[model samples]
Target: MKPARKLFLGARLRRLRRDLKLKQVDMAGKLGISASYLNHLERNQRPVTATVLLRLAETFDINVRQFAAEGGELAGPDQLSEIFSDALFADLDIGRQDILDLSDHSPGIAEAIGRLYTTLTETARRQSPSDTSDPRSLITPETWVRDHIQAHRNHFPALEEAAETVGGALANRLTMIDTLCHRLRDAFGVNVEIASSTDLGGATQAYDRSRRTLFLNALLRPENRAFGLAYQLSLLEFDAILTRMVQEAAPSDEGVARLLHMSLANYAAGAILMPYGRFLESAERHGYALDPLCGEYNVNVEQVAHRLTTMGRTGAEGVPFFMLRVDPAGNVSKRYAGESFPFSHYGGTCPRWLLHLAFQTPGKTITQLIETPDGERYFTFCRTIERPIRPTLTDDHLLAIGVGCHVRHASRLAYAEGLDLAKGMATPVGPACAICPRLDCAYRATPPAGHQLAIDETRKTISPYPFLAD
Candidate 1:
């Protein structure tokens, strides 16, 4: 079935009526509709139908296509609404009507405001979490590191090539531990050993150059012990390559560039563990299943999740998944994407997103089909992964790792086995409720900025606030 051809001429219609110095009844009579119906049109309650559009253009002596051919082509209203939703403008009492007028007549100013709002948002994300509200902390190293990786879609070509070369050096090796230990000793003469957690001062992996040994957390499982070695190996053997990439990246912020040094090495570690070609093949054969791939590759769940998001290699791309890791408090720690999605970069992801709930069922993978307010759909899966401090210690880091791709590729995933793509709620979600355009969601945290607020003493709805007559 064909979608409806809807139009939004409310702002323009009202402007035309006012310019002609005519009242609602006069315009309604001219257009052959009830005055209430004309009121609805002026309020954007209904799309301007072709018949009404023809009447409007003829009555106003204007080009019919001006009001019909590209109806809704200008979406300044939606963008401006997003801009005003920022906490910076939260105090202002701007209404939907004002937004519409601004976009309808002064679109340039509205767009400039929107751009400024976007810049503010990007900068805010860089601020240290401890001093997020301080304004000055808005330029932090973590932000730059994240932005740099995001720009590259978390795939560094030079690092990947270096990692492949490193992998090729031990093509016939069996165990990662034995292979990496031999390479480290033979190439750099650095010994690898798994030490008691306290010996490494509780660090997952530590290097002691004076002793010529790399100490890993004794509590780590065999796979993690190997990963610890792999991480050190990348820094040890590919130091020059990683350093060159960091230098070439050369962020204006010294702190950011310094942070990328570590980020690049970590990227190399993941690449080396799951060499691009073999990992891509395993991912495809396993339906990109996290656990199975984790087992086959001898890595942890988070490692597999992180690696899956980096399959954006040219001429050999895999499904573009957007991966995000969050703590119990909903603080996003790491986010990597091989494609764009509607989640917020600076604010809390929608509480309604299942990734948040994944914590409740630790170690269990939850599959979901999500549809954002904009109508984009995704096939997403998430599970909780625990990083223990030691073998017998109670202290651990519980994080939820989520990975998803656009829904068109749903069939390719094992998680999508029983999903009814055609007839499910599809979990209407968005970046965050403040700027989200979904009017019907009961989970909205705040009302969208553009709409007028109404207090109806006689009626109540499921959500705390109900929008007045739209």
Candidate 2:
């Protein structure tokens, strides 16, 4: 038989034993091996045979393949190879064996260098504006959305159903808000106490550790109070269900997975308040109207808009919706989509879209059909809602929140209908910064860094122009 391949198995076994807080004598006794032999094996002075390997497997009750395979431990050569292959270290000229020695002996240093490289890359991506000249692009918004969706595999049927049912039940009852609060307290064993600012003492929702109860400040607007109650209930009741959904999705990217976890938690809260089937039924019944949904659910315009976009819960999926919320200064606060919405990589939003005009009519809602320069048309509605900064506290400030959705899904909405979205009514929209190159755009903030700019001082084009090469 071939000489038993050692392959660092003995060292791994020794480490595992030490980790389990077992001594050499104890390990040897358990394995039916002499202490001297075990010592020799651990020190790499002797190779482990099949008999000892089998005994170790039996004792640990683990698969032999896992023990044989490098269990989170990398060898000197493997570590060195990874370091050498790293893009940041491509310029470094070092001997192979030397790199291996450093990796084996000074893994901490290697890890530090790797982290530094990652940090530098991230910083560069964030700071660089021009995409034409810069090679490393920060994660695109579309990619981010895609990853978020993939992480959850678009499974949230429970949330959709919940949002629909709860939304409908709250439609007709003036005491519905009180009833829902009672249900939350009864189901979750948590009291729903709405006290004044003095009672809450500056906290929006205070969780009393001793009493094991929650206190909501009464200063919050009616809509916000309902949302807060539902959000808390979601944490209490649906956390395990959300966890199982994420686990089933099995996200590959760590960052995306973390975001998805947070997003799902938020979704569960919204669903608990809105309930999918009822919400959908209500939307259809109300002719996709926002005002009635808000009054019915005791939620704000923004909350209703957000909840509407999340109707993509499995079987009873609503028309694939894309939602975007931007401030008056063109800062995007929230963006979620069931359909792909092309976003700019760099600076200001497309000027032609009603999102900009919505700010002009702050409290009023405007519905419009938007078509991008690339001929992608969407039915969009824009409106601003005042959100209290500190809902339950005295220091609360009212901030205007903007909300919009894709136009194709607008027929079901109560907003302006019978508008021809397909008749090319939308103006072209492009990325705000160096990422988009619409030559005729009057609102182009900066020339796309990726394109070559030809400045002719004598002949200024209508737009801050860049030369399109053949």
Leading candidate by TM-score: 1
Where does the lowest 10-residue lDDT sum fall in candidate 2? 70-79
Candidate 2, residues 367-468, lDDT tens digits: the string is 667665545677766777675435434632333333344565666666646666567456666545444546666767665443457788888887776556
* lDDT tens digits, residue span 1-470, model 1: 76754676676677679758999999999989999999888776777888997787667664454334322222355556656776666678777678866665554466456445644665755454454444324546676677668645677777788788887666443477788888889988999877887877778888998999998887787777877788888888888887778776776455566678888877888888888888888888999998889888778898899888888766677887889988888889888877766556457787777997887899899988888775878888989987745455465568898899888777778888877776766887787677776666788788765455665789777766556434
Model 1 poorest ten-residue lDDT run:
66-75
What TM-score should be assigned to candidate 2?
Answer: 0.62
List residue ranges in candidate 1 displaced over 4 A.
1-83, 90-138, 171-174, 388-396, 468-470
Tell me each candidate's TM-score.
0.73, 0.62
| Candidate closest to the true structure, highest lDDT | 1
